[model samples]
Target: DQQVKQNSPSLSVQEGRISILNCDYTNSMFDYFLWYKKYPAEGPTFLISISSIKDKNEDGRFTVFLNKSAKHLSLHIVPSQPGDSAVYFCAASRTMEYGNKLVFGAGTILRVKS
Candidate 1:
């Protein structure tokens, strides 16, 4: 079973509007949460990330929030543009002795309508 899940498979927002992408995880041991954006025929690129200890993290127009108590996380993009359209994947991981055990959600397709 998938430990990480994105409840919504797709989201559409008008350009210059706020786009909020949500994710949830069943694993409580996860210490990190990350958001990745993938474009057509391109590799997924890291967007924003938040540590479980912190409630929120912001980078440019992108912000990530983590709610450990709820086992949930979200990415918010302000004034979303056409260029922001892509598939977003939420990931969670915990550090182990050997490495990190990362689990990814199915992904949410974001369409920014201009």
Candidate 2:
């Protein structure tokens, strides 16, 4: 079974609107949660992150929320622009014997219309 899941396969929004992406996890051992944005022919770039201890974290137009109790997280983008169109991924990591290993969910493609 997949530890991380993104039920929605895609999302669409108009420019200057809000875009919300949701994710769920089955692992309680995951302490760090992150969101990454990926473009075609490129790797995913780190976006926003939240620790299990924190309920929310924000940076500029991006915000990430974590609900430890529910094992859920969500990423929100405000004033979504056309350039924001890309695949968004949710990742979780836990400190292991060797190092931190990340488990990623299937990405959600976001389409931002101008």
Candidate 3:
């Protein structure tokens, strides 16, 4: 079965603190990893991504690290802001899938206290 798992359903933190979300995968064939963020009724927006060729990737306030041997990945947000309170989904795919189809986790809801 090709699936990604996010064990935590939610996380809460005060602003200006660090937030970490974890994910695990069962498929060793997966080569592409992504983190998506969503608000209310809106669709997920890509926050950051990494290729299996690399161990880590970073964006402005976000970072994603992939550990191929462990079949795990994580997203880190530093100095978390109130606006970061939302649902975060960890997604992964196999490159052979062609169009980068995503297998998303149930999503972790983050609450950033002001």
Per-prediction TM-score? 0.95, 0.96, 0.95
Instruction: Pull out the clashing pairs in model 1.
Output: none
lDDT digits (tens) for residues 1-114 of candidate 1: 999999999999999999999999998888888999999999999888888889999999999988888898999999899999999999988865324566899999999999
**For model 3, how big is the CA root-mean-square deviation?**
1.1
TM-score of 1: 0.95
Better of 1 and 3 by lDDT: 3
Q: Tens digit of lDDT per residue, candidate 3, span 2-112?
A: 389999999999999999999999988888999999999899998999999999998888989999989999999998999999999999888777568888999999999
Model 3, position 55: C-alpha lDDT score? 97
> In model 3, how large is the Cα lDDT of residue 103?
88
Model 2 per-residue lDDT tens digits across residues 1-114: 999999999998999999999999998989899999999999999998888889999999999989898999999999899999999999999866324578999999999999
Off by over 4 Å in 2: 96-98
Worst 10 residues of 1 by lDDT: 94-103
> What local lDDT does model 2 show for residue 32?
90
